[model samples]
Target: MTYKANLTQYLSNEFKRLYEEPFNTDVTVQVGEEGHSKIFQAH
Candidate 1:
């Protein structure tokens, strides 16, 4: 297979694994103005 195809396959498998068994962690993202921004999280 081509390099691009192999890379795509690898990414696909990684996403599948992540969806099937995700990490038990929290992530926070703040968008917009620093103080006025909102925080988003996935627990």
Candidate 2:
């Protein structure tokens, strides 16, 4: 897999983990140089 693919996969997993508590966590998947990142901010 390419670097971006790997990063995307990693970010996807992070989203799953963060989204576990959908009511509490504001999980956002954003595109970046690497591929993606999960941003979590308390609401």
Candidate 3:
């Protein structure tokens, strides 16, 4: 209902999707072009 609540929901859903990937597979975190890609961890 509130701005914070909406953002929280979106982040939670994203976390679930990323977590559901194969346990051993690295979750790629792309931000820009292929030369400027970035990988990050949830924690």
Candidate 4:
């Protein structure tokens, strides 16, 4: 698999793991290069 594919899979798994647990607030995940990052929110 390519780097992009691996990264996507990694982030997907992280999100799944986070969501699988009980939480009372929003969750944010950071994904991107060293100098730049994007945030993804899940509740």
Candidate 5:
């Protein structure tokens, strides 16, 4: 499977594991260049 597809599956499984239910909410992942972690905002 593709990276995004795998990520989506992982997110769903994780959400379910935590909440004991399926993940129905939308997800958005923003990637950046190396050393750009500082630019991303914390959720």
Candidate 6:
């Protein structure tokens, strides 16, 4: 598996854990080089 694949799986699991459903919504995210930073904005 590549880095992208692992990240995708992790994000999917997290979405399900937090929302109790699959991550099926359209979304965008900004990640910093530190790898632990996430920024979300509503437009």
lDDT (10s digit) by residue, model 6, range 1-43: 9999999999999876765422223433333334322222222
> Against the hidden true structure, what lDDT does model 6 obtain?
0.51
Model 5 scores a TM of 0.46
**Which stretch of 10 consecutive residues in model 6 shows the poorest summed lDDT?**
34-43
Deviation from native of the Cα of residue 5 in model 1, angstroms: 0.1
Tell how far residue 43 is off in model 6, in angstroms.
Answer: 30
Residue 4, candidate 2: C-alpha displacement in angstroms: 0.4
Q: Model 4, range 1-43, lDDT digits (tens) per residue?
A: 9999999999999987775542433332333343222223233
lDDT of 1 by residue, 1-43 (tens): 9999999999999986775343332322323444423222233
Shift of residue 33 alpha carbon in model 4, Å: 34
lDDT of 5 by residue, 1-43 (tens): 9999999999999876764422222321244544333323322
Error of 3 at 7 (Å): 0.4
C-alpha local distance difference test of each model: 0.53, 0.55, 0.56, 0.53, 0.51, 0.51
Off by over 4 Å in 1: 23-43
Off by over 4 Å in 2: 21-43
- Model 3, 1-43: lDDT tens digits are 9999999999999987765453325434433445323223332
Backbone clash pairs for candidate 2 read none
Query: TM-score per candidate, in order?
Result: 0.46, 0.45, 0.46, 0.46, 0.46, 0.47
Q: 9, model 6: CA deviation in Å?
A: 0.1
**Overall local distance difference test of candidate 4:** 0.53
lDDT of 3: 0.56
lDDT of 6 at 34: 41
lDDT of 1 at 15: 82
